[model samples]
Target: MTYLKSAYKNAGIHHKMILLIIVLMLVNFAVFAVILKYIFHIYDNQMYKKTSEVLNISSIGIENELRNIEKTTFKVTTDEQLQRYLLQLESETSPYTKMVLRKKITNRLIAFAGSETYVYSMVVIDKEGQVMSAGNREGIPQELHSTLSELADEYDGSNAWYAAGHSSLVAARQFKSFTDSNFTLNGLGTLAIRVRIDRIVADRVQTSGRDGQLTITDGKRMIYPETPLLSESDMQAELARKQPYGIATYSGGTFFAAQVKSSYTGWTYLHMTSFDDMFRHITIIKEIVSTIFVIMLLIALALGTRLSGSITKPIVQLIQNMRKIEKGDLDRLEEEALGPVPFSTQDEVGLLHRTYKKMIRRIRELINENVAKQLLLRETELKALQAQINPHFLYNTLESVNWLAKANKQDRISEMVEALAFLLRSAVSFEEQLIPLRKELDIVRSYVTIQKTRFDERLIFQLDVPEELMDAQIPKLTLQPLVENAIHYALEPQIEPCRISIVARVREGSLFLRVEDDGPGIAEGFLEKLHSGQVTTRGQGIGLANIQERLHLIFGAPWGMELHSESGTGTSIHVCIPYVKGDQGHVQGAVG
Candidate 1:
């Protein structure tokens, strides 16, 4: 139970988990806001678009109705009986005949007016400013009479003439008489039809509450609804100019208004609908979305708090364990006590725990093994170093005796002893693995000095070394062995003086040392076998092989020794190494 609790505590909430929740919430909110805003805008625009379409349709219907009324009035004005009565009145001289014609004309006009619902009244006026036939004079304003008289003067006795108003529409036609082939005139008379504009408006306004209010206006006055509308001066100013169907607001409410201009008579029609009714559905949807968002937020908060704690506890415990490891408390690490701390998931943290446990086991094993190997290797190197001293001591003792005899003028015997001493010194002192180019030169000089004494001018030696490369390091006794081999093969059996040359110089940032002997050059197969590590000569010893190995180890295979020879020309052994002057210790112990 305690282990379980510790694991839970360690697995604390990840910051990424919290951040993920925040991002999700914000994204959801943003998406909801976008959808809501778009839906509301689409709904509002569609409502206005649909309203405009309806108003346009209504204007067309009203225009058609007015047109039908004009057709009916035109038929009545051109009737055969009315035309004949007017023609008879033109020739009537008797007062009794004149009265009869007048009565016929008046009756005809009265019958036509009563037959149509849209025609409020009809009237005939004579050329002498005398009214002949009239209907429903009660509804006709007195001020309109003079306006009618002016309209009559402009009429050229056509089939029909019409005028439109905010509340009504009117049509007028002039009457003329025809007698035989000549036209005879009694009086110029006018026939007029009056239309009820309110009835046409009533047909177009819908009764649905969501359809909003409808209003009609002329430039100067409100006609339909017949009440004051859009009382706000600012709103009124905006509506005063004619505009096609679009959204606008007034003192009472916001609305969409459409205007139609009549082609038959130059009158403007306005249709207005309130904005409040158009967007009512959108308000309901917004309220629903807001409520849902609140409820979802409450649910998310409740669930997130609990889940975050569950995830965070185990992570916290893991962090504490890591801190203990950092403090070097490896023994205190509760490996078994860590017990399978349930990450409870197959993700990266679980993999990390498994990997860490395996790494700890491997690390402990490596640490113990490394410690043991270090001690053993140190003891073995010490033994190898101790084994190098006995040969060097014996060679030094022999050299001391040779120098003593040379001081006593015992020259021939001293020379032989000196040669043996130098050979022994070169063969020993293997522990001093690297020596300077100058030191190698000194060893070679000592060997050559003894050789010259023994041979008595039969062997000639030349040494050419650059001053700059004198201190460059090489393997100890590297050049001495090569020089000995050259002397043995080239001069020991020669009849006259044999020329031996040693040259040391720096070439292309590497040291080049060459030993050339002017004697019958090596056997063709012998040089190949020497470089291939195949021993060829009966007693060649390991001199050349050892030098090649040391060169290979110090400077790698490419920078090692190369032998060039021709049977009669002589043999030259060349050694190449990177010039490193101050790296004596590294040169002495470096492995090929």
Candidate 2:
């Protein structure tokens, strides 16, 4: 009975709590609905309309280019030079005379077709299946004879037509001979021009406006300016459908995409504008709304707290206890009991108080369970580390000696051995402490020198270290791991010679060390995973992960690794550590 009363009193619910929650929820819902309808919906609709306009413009441009090619083919076929070539071939009978005629015709056709920018290739074939003239014989397909025969019948052996293929657009025209004085027409030969479709699409795609695509298709096959967004089968399936459809989806927090079919070509053109690019204003609005919501929430909490205190004393005490629990205190409730009340209450305040007690108990149990598990995990990790030191220590010692012997520098070798000894001593003696930037760079240089001997001519190293930043404090062995990572991941895979650059500079009292490589860059999606501290299937190479962990532990969130890369370019790892000069140590790089 005392427990029930105590729980009721400490629940911290009042009439004002009910009223405030109801009002805020209603306000939030109404605002969200109104904004969604007026702002987001209308904006998306406008985007769809704009996308359709762009598709229409692109369709018109493509149609115009196709028409231009057809017009050019018509003009070339009717030219006086082409007629003369055909007449010369028809009049000849001897093999030498025919060969001479064929050469003349070939030269004339080449001169006429080569003058145009878009004409990929031209070929002239006689009615007797003899090749008379040709420019770029590679363009002439094996199936040309059949195609020309059909074309010859359609246009009375003088008409022009376009053929669509996998990688080329063929424009063929048949020429005739006027031999007799009666002006009778005789089939002479065919002229065919092939144009690269990819190049043509590329040129048109470039001129298309934002989010616009130029699509070329003839009933079955389609060519899109953009690479296939949908699978080939999916595209074909979508194209097969007769009715026009449009849909908008939120992809990566931005709305982008509109598809339209060309009535003439039966090709669908899809225009995609990044929502992030288009509706920046919405993000701004969301930020403003979020800021306003936070401000209002704070104000509401303050008012609710003050108002509820007067009406409910026991409830206020319960809230204070809950705050203690929030601060990780799960001992016991400090407040006393209030009067008896049923668990089922019509009032909102009573319901809230009942729910609060149940939640507090559950949270306390979870914390206790989590703490025990964490302690066990930490113990297991410590045991694992203790078991794996001898092998690592021996390996590092051997590597130091090898580096010394290869360099042939006794003095530097002695210094490096001493440094390695000191590092080992520090590791065994002192747990871990921040060290000078000079010490870190020394370790990094030694590591690089060791790797350099292995790679020899294939690896080149450059360093740009400012004198002023040498003494800046940093986590021990901080720079070494990053440099090692640059070598292992960036340079090791390359067959060609690679360059590794290390730059250390001071920026506004903060020391920055950048390790860079001119090898195949880090794989795409690596940066996001590294930044988020997400465990990936491909392990973060050796020292890279260790360096990041140490930075985070010593300098919190801001002073850690920043990675940048592009495929085929290379990768860069930037380490930011706070600078401290003389006795005046600034606590600017405190860990979170």
Candidate 3:
């Protein structure tokens, strides 16, 4: 309740109605008995800590399938071609070379007993005892020549589990020939394998249901999964109650068990359960929170004694309509909070005076839709700056025909109409969208003086540019559409003459410039339609994708343009800006 209105808004109204009726009846009986005692301590200590995290996640998936059957019994017992065909089939007195060294060691134990599924069989015995089995040798039942002398007198070549009298379990390993430790001959004979331990702990005791009772052991015996609640005196009173690794609570506490152990078959695992069928949902959430905490404590002491005299008159008219909504007059909260909330009853101070007049009509429709979306985004950015005004009236009629060709003295028609009126006043400039690399090299020297009076002497232009980068800052006509996409793709067609350079450097911290052009270049089907922008028509006035979209709309997304072409070795292009100068940094948004 807004923390009981900021802990009884400066207590006085009969000590804030008896501290809101003794803090809403002791915060509803101490948060309903601390949420039913934290859901009975998460269902009796998280159901034996989720059965020791499902027996340590089923002993990490049966120790990754018993370390892939101990890496397929150490790759068929360190196979030097199955140990030189089991040391030449132990001196083959030739029964057809001992049946071709037992068909090449049974085709390499048919790839570790045809790859896993709990690898039921894969034997390979040797040192003169010739045995070469593969998978499901009927999941190994008995006589491997009377347990090869009880597995070479209990040889510890590792993986030694043993059992296999039908209910499987035999992991065995015994292959000796460490290639001549004096032929270490007595036993290159047992790789038994079998493996079933109820199919390797059957899906982790099927997730601890049936009130548990899984078992494993290996601290000297009990491996097969014999049940009847682990018999022999309930497996010595459920592995003698008190846990060693994880869960515990014994029969006296109505059971819980858990355990785990494993570290690759040192086997312990345990499991158990019961505690009234594992917390029967914390005893059905303590009988639905003791019947909703005794029917919300008799409906909060019968609406706190019929809300003690109009609950301090709607919290003193909601503190004088929240001091007239904290003084920022919410448009006269529908005429001063509707004459002190005429919300004729229906609780919580009439839903706080109809949610304070629906929050002052959603704050006057979000302040008239944010002042009509900021005056329609400033009338769509001044109608896109009035479409760059009519190209400044064609640069004021090419500055009155370059002052009537310099009052008729006609010095080359007034320097080609003053370089076509400085390329029509920097192409109708919309307030220096970044300029000065000396007015973008005076609009690329008046667009190479009107493309050198129409390619006279087959056009040749070079600019090496660096009078301290003629006052750096770029993106105006970013080097006149890369010198008009290098005179419309390296000098129009190609009757030879086309050298156009334009350079400018400053490597790492950006600001490159390039442009180069020995002509006949960009053709591989229009340089893959100008690097896939699918370049539409216009070639010179503005095309290399409109000066690489005005160098990513005036130097923003890491500035732009980068076309280094090469057909007959020509087109260069570069551009890439971001050196920044004038108003030292802060553009980051002009993608148009």
Candidate 4:
């Protein structure tokens, strides 16, 4: 099975199409053959039924005729003249009187036989084998007289019909004295009626001029029309199979035969006909159908070759062009190789060819654009390298200003410049995003020093962070933003003294830090504006929103800042972050 599948897969479209057509044709032929066989079976059953019907009709007619013969036999045997004459013939020994009695009995037999057209002869035999006859010149065979008498005696006064010869039927009965009712069954002599059975069958049975022949069996022997297709014993064996009415092959399997047994006579009637003759037309039809199928198959093969060739030709050309492209000949794709037509149409093959051409053009354009972009990127990198010394220049300039303030005996100016330089360095540096809380506090203290010089003594700054949490890791410059917002929003707006406090501790495995201010608290909705980044910071630093974003970015969720501020009261901002020791081991489920 695997080999067949592999072979089919490797076969070209043309051969595969031919094979497919042939397979389909064979399958159709099989279905047609089955249907034809079923039709033949139906026709066969119809034939059997029709033959059985005809046989049944003929049997009925023959039975009626035999019944008439039986009635005639009964009338003759019970006749007072015939019965009395036969009894007297048994006792009388005078030749003249005996001859007279024989003549009278013969006349009576002739009278009885003349009433039926098919009765050939009628004869009576006494116990001593004296024969009296009528209706035919040839009488009963002398050799058959005793046999006929014995058969008649076995009937015991009832009519017993049997086939006499190839062409005749004999009904034999024993006659008794009708004068005494008690002696009615007593046997006196045998009376036999020889009937022309051929004449009776000829008038009664019709085969409609078909080749069908009839065979009658008396359960033991063939009875009529001497040339039987089967012997008596063979026919009896066939009948003994006991299918009363059905069709089957018989007569050495030469003919299809239907048989029906008569209920009245117990004889089986068969109608046999040659099988070839019976199914000749059906055979011819089958032959014609088979021939047509084969012719159609040949025509389909011729058509399939042309069809597969048309479909596969374009596909093969496209594959050839793709192979050229695979070999790096991007410009070698010819319009003719794409499809039969240079321009596209609505069909899928046409669409595929057009799309391939478009893709090739796009590839060339992108190659040129990518080269130009690469040149521009190299030039920009050189300029960026030239500008790398700017940060050091700014730091050196601030250090020079700080020393000049100290030399001028300007203490406040020197302190502010030193703090500004430190803040500048911390903001500009990008070495590590996470720093120890103690380092972040140093940066915050530097920012507060600069703000405190600006606010004088009105800014009351307090630091309440614990010593143990100083080693905890937090994002660099995180606390400076919140503390600056408090000074700008809480203290800078009022002339009176306002206090700002930075409180830090560990709670539920997280560092919770709050920057509280006691100035005129943030105005209504200003805290919202501040958190949404709508309110710009007055100081040169990242706002509270930026710090919240930075904390969230580093520690994921539940680790941002929350603001609590009300009008005429202090504003407090809570900053929550995951607790990590200075070595950077993280605490899980810590942020709240």
Candidate 5:
């Protein structure tokens, strides 16, 4: 075992994988074979149970049918009217009286035979040569006297049943004198009822699944079927076994044989099912499964070889690249043969190759990073100086304009100047990305005031923010862009007055600020174009998409802008943010 382990450890990965796969397939196939055997065992058990139940039920049915036949024979033999008529017919010598007596007995026999579907015929024989019969047969049966003699001697006064032919049976009972009860034992005549055994077997005997032959015996000979499928001696021998039911062998063929003995008639009902016939499909399935297992083993071997090679080839290439790097041949690593496409297989080997390449590039980038950093610092300083100068100059100019308008008694001009100053300050401030709700709304109100002066009654702006939530912190410029979008898409297109409302509410630990307009809604597919930055705006202003990105950067997921609108149903934009009270400190790094 130690030597084998050492050999396996020394083997290449491809060969190792192939060996492991073969071993696994062998183990799996062994388990499958065991499971198949267990399944077959269960199937055999089920078949046995079903066959036993059918045999028992069939035997009971046949027994009941035979009992009914016995009752009919008993009723006919002890019938007082029939007994008196038979005796009178035996002693009377007048032709007309004899004919009348025989007719009456024949009518009684016909009635008895008609009452049972399985009964074929009925006959009565007095002590003399006279015969009275009914149904199917017009005259007496062959050797009726001898048959009755045998039955009378064997059964005494009880009913006796014996096979009449291949498909029929005869039941015999001694008709006795009913006038004198003490002399009832004296045989006045013989009454025989012929039964259709085929009908009885058809109605009562049931075969289970598959092909099987049914044979019944009177503990003497085969009766129902004209001929036996098995040799008579073999069947009798199987019946003679101590076991009531089991598998037996006859003439080198296997059979499942079960027998039930009738309690009333003492007949044996044997069902012999050929083993080959019952399990022919099972045998075919075994062959098919074995063939499939062999085929799968072959396929697995082939696939294992290919898969092992595929897994190791990428690793081999990576190792070769490492060897080149060891020899200081880094230039050759970037050639067409070692390009990114060659190592882009989306596996660990590919990732390692890519990481190695990135490390090489990072080393070169670090060598020049110091110089690039110095230049970037100078450029940023110059831009910051310009940003400070321009915003300060703009605010100072707006203040001067407000003073000039107030001196001229131009109230509208002063109001527009103040609103413009406020809007400019809010847009230029880069110190905080989040501000109080009241401050953001103040900026929005200033912007709306300026727009209201321009549109007058055509722009009906309504604000419904609750006073309690005015101090909640939110992302700056959140509502300004949404209000601007409503004006552009909702108000500017129509001549009628558009009612634009901003409503704020607190829900589920968050604050929702909705901006709605009672104007024609934006067209379908326009929102998608807007989000994709395809819908170009007229001036230098932030779009709704910018607000969405800001919210995502500050609050991560699920807190962002949602828009709902339909044609002629107006438009509403909801800005969702976490409701944080008081100063939450300045959010860092996202102001720009």
Candidate 6:
């Protein structure tokens, strides 16, 4: 096993692929051969079975017609008028009465003959040798009388068919008086119904071979196929053997034959065929298929070298390049290391090389980019540290100014400076804690005092907040931004003083703070953008939207801000928050 493996490993890829193709071809042909043989046998068996079935069906149909003929003969004999006329014509010597009786019998024969398409001729021969006939009068010859009378001789009130000359199917039935008490042989007559055998088997034959023959035989003579495929002696020999049905010999092996017995008539149906002629196209098809297989195999061999080299050479180069990298020889990538070569076809190997080249280029770009990203990261860290120092410095300066104002005894300046210091302190600690509403109001008042110093009498504000909500806690700076906005947009740009009302109301276990300004109302477009948070205003330190988001973040999302304004009227901003005071979650649920 080791030696075989070594030899296979040493073999060229071209030889390996050719070997694989040869193995596949052999397996495919082996399976096709078995299926082909099976299909051939099935074709022959089905053809013979189909031929026998068709012939059997035709024979039954012909027997049914003959039975109808016999039944019609019995019906004619029972017609009392026709029977009386026949008997009267035989004995009456009056010429006028004889003419009338003959016309009546002829009319009766016409009725039976016209009833069925199978009836070629209907003839009735009385015991007195008088004859009456209807339908296809030209069909019966003068010699048909003697020939058909012999068939009627042995009949015991049933039908007997004969292979009459001129391809006639003759059924003879003996008619006797059903009502006469003295019914004897002399009183009986023959009713002969002649039909064309060619018409009986007209559309019945189904055979693939053009010269194939299907015939009905009465164990005495062939009854169909006016031109028989077998000679008279050969047909006689085949019939005499009485092989109920199945394979019979024909001209050498070129012809095939099978027989089936009719259930309606005790007749044998024979089918003869030339199988070689029928299956000659199959041989031609086999030859064509063999030619195509050989041609494809030759083409495969011709293209084997190029196809195998195209697949294996690129993969082998990629593997060698990988091995060099694995051994840490990546720095020695030079002319000695194989480069990618263009393929003559778009195959998997070509795709692999294309991807490998792209990967090598992308990896080099990524390494260079990663180094630049690390340097930018250090620069960003320095900027972040510088950003932290400025806020601390501003807070320190505010404290120093507050202390200096107090020591100098500038009472009003000291008050303003201390409020500034307290607001700055709250702002610094705002993110870390929640404050009481009173602390928020102090910040708003201090900010309002500072704003009033700039716009003396133009901003008149009132606080109508209830004492119950004064202790309720909320996010710091929630209401201050809204009040600052009312002072800025509503009072800052007006000559007349505008009144600002701050009211706190509790309803449905929730606290609602309303800030109203009776100044020129917000513009229609700006109000829409403000409500939708599409515009921002820095009236105080943050816009109304910022306080809204803060209230939502501190409480749940359901607590937020609401705004209502008219064009010429005033504006109102409502702050809706969960009512939480010192130790209470909500007003009614307050624990303290």
Name the top TM-score candidate: 4
Residues 140-211, model 2: lDDT tens digits? 666676676568657875444454555556767667555354245666677777755556565655434454
Better of 1 and 4 by lDDT: 4
Clashes of each: 19, 0, 1, 0, 0, 0
TM-score of 5: 0.49
lDDT of candidate 4 at residue 279, scale 0 to 100: 79
Give the per-residue lDDT of model 3 (tens digit) for 231-321.
Answer: 4555566565575533344434555666667766677767666667767876787788777767876676567656665777677777787
lDDT of 6 by residue, 385-417 (tens): 897788788778877886787788777776777
Better of 1 and 2 by lDDT: 1
Worst 10 residues of 1 by lDDT: 159-168
In TM-score terms, candidate 2 sits at 0.43
For every model shown, what is its TM-score relative to the native structure?
0.58, 0.43, 0.27, 0.70, 0.49, 0.44
lDDT of each: 0.68, 0.64, 0.69, 0.80, 0.80, 0.73
RMSD to native, candidate 4: 6.5
Model 2 RMSD to the real structure? 43.4
The count of backbone overlaps in candidate 4 is 0
Please say which candidate is ahead in TM-score: 2 or 4. Answer: 4
Please state the error at residue 126 of candidate 4 in Å. Answer: 5.9
Residue ranges of candidate 2 with Cα displaced over 4 Å: 1-19, 22-26, 132-138, 143-145, 148-164, 176-186, 206-213, 223-227, 240-245, 248-303, 314-592
Kindly state the number of residue pairs that clash in model 6.
0
Better of 3 and 5 by TM-score: 5
Instruction: Write one digit per residue (lDDT tens) for candidate 5, span 174-252.
Output: 8867667335567778887887777777788777335787778886766767766678789778878877677888984
Q: What lDDT, from 0 to 1, does candidate 5 have?
A: 0.80
Evaluation by TM-score, superior candidate among 5 and 6: 5
lDDT by residue for model 4 (336-419), tens: 334355563557767777777788777778877888988888888987677567878888998899889989999999988889
Q: Native-vs-model 2 lDDT? A: 0.64
Clashing pairs in 2: none
Ranking by TM-score: 4, 1, 5, 6, 2, 3
